[model samples]
Target: MKSNQFKIVIDDTREILKWISHISKWFFPLILAKNIIQATLPYIHILFGYLILDGIIAKDSSSDIMKNLYWMIGLNLGLGLLHSFLTRLLNVKTEYIHHATKAEIARKAQTLDYEELEKKESLDLLRRAEEGINSNGGIPSFCNTIGSLITHAITIVYSILLLSGLFIAAPKENATVLERVFNSPLPTLLFFILFASALFLNFKISEQLNKRSYAFFEENVDTNRILNYFGGVSNNYNFGKDIRIYGMADMIQEEMNQKNDAIITMMRSLGITYGRYSALIEIVNQFVIFSVYIFVGIKAILGLVSIGSILKYVGALIRFIGAVSSITIFYTQLDLQRQYLNNYSLFLNLENKKYQGTLPIEKRDDNEYELEFRNVSFRYPNSPDTVLDRISFKLKVGNKMAIVGRNGAGKTTFIKLLCRLYDPTEGEILLNGINIKKYDYKEYLQIFSVVFQDFKLFSFDIGQNVAASIDVNEEKVWKALEQSGISERVKKMDRGIYTNIYQNEENGIEISGGEAQKIAISRALYRDAPIVILDEPTSALDPMAEYEIYARFDHMVSQKTSIYISHRMSSCRFCDHILVFDKGRIAQVGNHTTLMKDEKGLYHTLWTKQAKYYN
Candidate 1:
């Protein structure tokens, strides 16, 4: 298990690298060339200043001095123009590549399976990916690091060349200046040690900060889960009234406040620690710079070297040190970014149990088909107890059956098995005497149109909501709306089919629960699927509205096989056959009239309890 998890992390990092490589292949060469030019230009400018100083100090006597002065002037002008153009080009190219990479990441995220995405661990990994790898500044920082590292490497090489040249140019008698500088050794060793210590401290501090940031992002997922649950409860009319009456609002507020305080406190402590380390690093950095300057200045004034040479050497050393420091920082950032990319890769690599086949069962229609469950049993992932146990049933094509069950009686789980949202753990589900696993998953999904108890309402126009896409016809949408009993209400609206139906935005209208259910039915009806499953479709509707919808539904799907699940005994009266479930077993199976007459039946008992309401 651990090894598999590690492989997933590796795969994610590889995917991130592939994205980086694609962007780099187009713009990296340009960025590299630009950095090379930029790095070399600074050295050229230093050399030009040295030449100009030499000419002025020598009273411009030699003819060579005049020629060198003109060369320096041309060099300065060309370098400035080249540097400016490259900088602008790189800036624009980086932005374009960054945007393209981010879009690819988002597209990949969207294509991931919904079931896998619902897992808490998967969500946490995705959060890390979004925050660490896909944030506004991350890709740009990555590209910049790559460019800076390459440029700094070239600058270090050039600095070494310049230093070597200085050593050879000095007269033999003046070699003592070089000896004193190199022999003392304490300053050079001290400077490097201090610089390395500061770099190490900065890297460690940044690592801690990244960890805290990741933790904060993970906490947000829990916070969002809590908020969504509260929002759902508060918006539910039945729950809302009681919640208010019991004064539970304060408890919800207190929970939210406590979570917010915890996050804020963690961030505050991280900030203080980061500040302290940064301050200490800076103080040490200043001392290192002061030591270098004091040693170099005394030698130049004692006539050991020319003032021009001192300026060139000091400037080159500073640039070299800066380049090395930047290179170190860039690699540290890369390591941090890679860590998050690994998390994303791990999420993307998880095995989706529902999609483990080459094809879903619904695709093959080689023979006259009947659906069968042979000794089927199932338990949810990571759960010990079975939700469905040793269940077996068969439904021939065109059979209209209703499943009746009390709460937690496994009626929904049976439907989910039929749809292959999950596979049976102990036995086979067969279509036309062949295992459903042999068929294509997508084609299998196409066979059934399911209206779940808790259906979604998209924040799109009515037409898009019903069709699940924008290409649906207005006429068909209106027909579906009417069939679902919402057309009259929709037609009265200002925009009819075109009106946005979410209250969160301007110019959008809020839809009632019953209206939302009608839209859901329309969506299912529009699919024109042969197998229709409705789970508590009338749960939110009044008797008249429910009767009206059932009438239209029966008319529109007269020839299609339908499965209606409801606790309301009156709703299933017209169903051709009813299968009542009790504690994960089939307690009774018969037509509604036959089941109502059976005195020992669970369905008969439920019917008696609910019949009083109608009477």
Candidate 2:
């Protein structure tokens, strides 16, 4: 990792620790205890092995040997049982931490400012953050780094202390390793040298193999993307129709095969090259083990060292090497997990561009809300041209306005600004004579109940979907459904108000497009805010159906301010006033009859064209 990346990783590590601590106060101590026990088990077993070997080799009495044998059996059985218990407890702890961290991530994503969430870069950041937190051992990119460090440090220190006895020459004399190698027939110094050289070479080879494998996977990520998207279309229910009707099976399969072949070739190249080095490392390890055993056996044969000494020395050497190796590998794994932690941290730490307002919108029983857009001009972030330029409008209680425009004419942009999804880049919006930004964001949002062109309905019970809450007002839900003209349809369902709107055969409930639209409209009605917006919610309905929806919607918005966006002139006729837009500018604004009579106006031109199309 680069310096900046490493900094991010460290920052993330601190944050992760904090989050884990917040979720479970005992989690860190628990992990540390478990790891300590795990690390000590091997040394304890090794000590028991030496005891057993010494008791037998010394030709001790039968009772002594039997006691040693019982100890060996008890050590192994007890350690195994202890390990199993710790593992189960750790798994539960990890699972609990993961759940808590995931919930935090979810809350962060949902509560992010609307404009930030809409930006592509922001969305990508959020996605990477989500992946980092959702990955294996992934709670805020969970890595047992601190625990591993503690465990390995203890193991290394203990193993080194044990091995210190063997490295010293016999007769307890001051010794250089060279003197020991000359004194011993086994060439002890050369054995050390060979082991050191083998370990160094093995480390290099292992590092290269890991690097190669990482590069291979990273290179193929985009290839997998193409394969998953187009290749797996058949598996995705949403794309099943295209696969069947467009005869896309063969094309998708062929593309998938080609992508897979490329990925497989990369995999093969990595395995072939890295496998040789891995095999070499294993061979070297085995050679070291074999040499150690032979030397120890020769020493025992010469009666230079007892059977117990042989077991102790060899076991200590094995433990030392393994601990050292684990320490080295632990650093690498820690770095990788740290990078993932970096992404998660970056996402959570992202600052909102727009500062949150502190002022509160005064509560009024009569719902006296006024929205005024004064010289508002907005261009999306990183865009050259303004989507809504120099737009100004005013709306008060008991007003219904229709916004008419062709595609890309800023009809939706106006709605977005009105709803404060994105603030105007150049001017302020006034709410009841004060800048909307001055009022509390949450309080301001409560004033409007909007159903956008691309509205979403939940796969929940009818009442829940309409009320946007599980604890629904049954009578209110039915009234809203009636206003949206979907009550009778819902009444016929198996569960009535509690019926699932979208589900499979188990639930056996699915609604048509028009029916879904009505449900969305019902959602707006249930909110019953002072300002209402229906941005082409009836687009899927026929002209007569659209008119009926408009008629019902007008009745529903009785005393509330309303904004209706539609391309169909028939829907515009239902509004008290119509605002015609062309290329982000308002071309005309008037009642329907006046606009239609003015033949030279943009509204007249659009109205004529739409009426002709409908006819």
Candidate 3:
């Protein structure tokens, strides 16, 4: 194993030990006592059998001998019952501890960053965590196996001691023949070799099976995405009619079938591999057992050993083989668990490189704040071309700036930089003559309230979703709703603001796309920040509703710094400044009237093309 692999195994062992220490403090003494009682009972059974056999062989059927034998039998039976009860009690206690530890690990996983979880490498690690928990049914089972293996090893030692005592006591009898027969080291060594080979083969088979299982899991994840896409066709209000007219059900079903067939083929191949290895291991185990039985039977037929001595030797050998097998199996399981721990360790070590230096930003004393981009340039991580190239512009506080651009004109990328989602690749962005980098990230985000076209709505109450992370009052929530022109629709509902918005759960009420967008806008307004960004917020609404929403936007955000992005040319009429972006640079900048006068400008070409629809 590599050094890192060793470290991960060591960490996992420490985790296991921590759990063991906790359970031992409370239940260890009880477990140890129970195991001792269990181990003692097996010897008690052996003693009872020895006394009865001796009485029969000697023809001593006296009343005292018979009575003593009956008492021994009763005591042995009681001890057996006690052993069974304690085993069940230990199993239940171990299960409880396992579930508690799994819960703690799951909670720790949830605290990880959302972006880190979305990475491709992280997905496989997450899958391993799932499989590890499933394989052992939780952490406690892993620990319980170690404890039970230890207990069984102790039992094996006790059985060997009892057998040795029996051989010494029967030295003059034919029963002493078994002690001489097994005393040879050659037979014991052969048994160990065969069993070890079989165990190693079994481990190889199980590891291959686990690898195939994970491959199937990953393929199913892709299949689920396809299913979700098709399931939306019939219920999507915007696309349902188009789908019905096109009759796309057969096409989608065929695609889904192809994905399913691919998974089935991989599973069949795995099953074949597992079957071949399993059969070979089973045959080897059977051969080892047959050889042991043949050698012992020859001695008994030759009158070299008594029937009782032969029975005792066979029992001891079986118990020893069983203990060795259990240890081998546990080691294999430990190896598999270590593989999962390594994956989890990788996930926890995901890179989160922090920005080195901070840029200074002047605090605004007045309501107005000036923003500037000084030769700003930027590119996304792992991408070659710059999305914004040497772009420079200025916006006065409380000014409504309309940014218009054709598709792929770098309009959205420019806004993303202003929001500081990704820092500039080359140049700097300034707020009040200070680099925005100097301000705290969270504090900087608080300066603006934005609603993008692809905004997400969580499965929460309408009011809570809008006033995100803030203590919301009913009066303020309703006021924001009223300002966004969605209060009338909300007031008509029976549950009003408290109604859940997801349709999958009981009592959840689903709203229209336009209504969802309005709720998003209401959330942005509730923030009451100085800067507001609306990226095509009214795209899903009707023409009349869209115009009315923009009219309300102008009134409600009158004295705030507003940046509006839209394909609709008419929306730019109310803005004090309009910027037309071409490729990754600013092509033109002026008020609507001036831009309209320049026929060669990109904005003029776009407006002329749109004006044809009205004509």
Candidate 4:
């Protein structure tokens, strides 16, 4: 058990260092130099002060005293400047590490399997991980704590070295009993034992404090998430209308106040506990200081050590004991940081169950990619009911196909499976002849452009949105806009293709739902993949606007294999083939005329009902 825990600590330490180095390769080396300077400066001042005092008391030459003073002042100024420069540089690097960690977390989320991402467990884990990061101040705080620990250790070592002579020197033969006792090695041993005991007590206190802190964070993760949601929603423009209409402001305020009060109460309790421990620590520290003064003063009175030496020894002993206590506190802090980091570590280490195949997708100039679902069945993760059960169909190359179904008819599930968002629970989907999973995940996705029902457009400029990248081709973007019938609307804007979507920035435009749908369509057209699938992206548009999209879609799709999913039965009449889905199964497949001939068929029933409603 101990070995396992040791290995975990080693791994977490390595992980922390890995991120530090990854963010800035020179961080550790420069921070070490900075710490060394920080540790040495105080000792230099102590030693210099002792030398000058002794010189003055002993009637040494003025030239010798002035030279020593000059050296000390010059060294401090030079090293201090270097330390300041390094500190500023390391601060910027630390900020980079802090922000980059958030970006890395987002990147990890995007790359995770869609199935895994959908689970509540994943979201809860993410919340806990973020809490840990916030509590520990992320990697930056950990790095700083370790540097402080090193500095304290260095100071202690230096103190020990300087005071060794005081411990080993012999007392004068005519010394008093008390002076002899103080001069003996026993005082030295007693100081060591006292320092060790103080350190042990410090560790025990620090452990309790850190453990309480960890518990507070752990117990409040859910509450904090709720608080964050309420906080964000209050500021969200999207929720403004509902909030105002429902008069939710007072309710939200009440919840916020309650949560804030709870957190404050817990903090007050924690602070009280800290205060008590702090008082105890101070007492221990004062006792050590008293012991040091008596030991050093007795030697000074016996004329065995100079007044300057007494001052030096007392300062060294106090600093040495303080360093030991600080080291204990810092080590416990490292342990706390390690615990916090475990959440983020576990989150990052989550396995991607979906196989990422290495084989490159076959490229063809003719744009004739064929897809076949061979007895594919799927159920969402941890779901008992199957969404798509033993459904099999082949999409014709370069042909327009329409899938018409009622709500909960598995139309979207089929699209999701074809898009490889979730792998089939049984059988497999084939591209050309080989299983689709055999092709590289990213490479396979490149073959199709899909506009889902709930597609999102960012707050970027229209050109970048269409291109889906920073390097936008203005010509291609305009062409796509024209094809999608939103060019005229875009042309009217002052910035035209450069106009920003949504009111997220200065001079940004808030487009209508119809305009947003057109932009989404334009984005798909810009991709110009071999296969185009529109899963009711036109739902937000009016009847005429939706018709216009379908009307221009053929010219827009050109020679690509197009799959259109819609609820309007009349709109699908233009397609050569139609699929009718019912209860997670393909109940019928035929052209409109062919299916309309069968009066009792599901397609005929749907078409007749829709036609009657229009009439």
On lDDT, the stronger of 1 and 4 is 4
Over the stretch 17-132, how does candidate 2's per-residue lDDT look in tens digits? 78678778888877777678778778876777787778887887989877877877887688778778877887888888778767877777888888988888777666666656
What are the lDDT figures for the candidates, one per model? 0.73, 0.77, 0.70, 0.86
**Model 2 lDDT-worst window of ten:** 134-143
Candidate 2 whole-model C-alpha lDDT, 0 to 1:
0.77
By descending lDDT, how would the candidates be arranged?
4, 2, 1, 3
User: By summed lDDT, which 10 consecutive residues of candidate 3 come out lowest?
Assistant: 165-174
Instruction: Count residue pairs with overlapping backbones in model 2.
Output: 0
> Estimated TM-score per prediction?
0.82, 0.89, 0.77, 0.94
Better of 2 and 4 by lDDT: 4
Residue 242 in model 3: lDDT: 69
lDDT of 3: 0.70
In candidate 1, list every pair of residues with a backbone clash.
12-345, 359-439, 359-440, 359-441, 360-439, 360-440, 360-441
Q: Which tens-of-lDDT digit does each residue in 398-430 have in candidate 3? A: 899999998878888887888876678888888
Cα deviation in Å at residue 115, candidate 2? Answer: 1.5
Native-to-model Cα distance after best TM-score fit, residue 39 in candidate 4, in Å:
1.0
- Top TM-score prediction, candidate number: 4
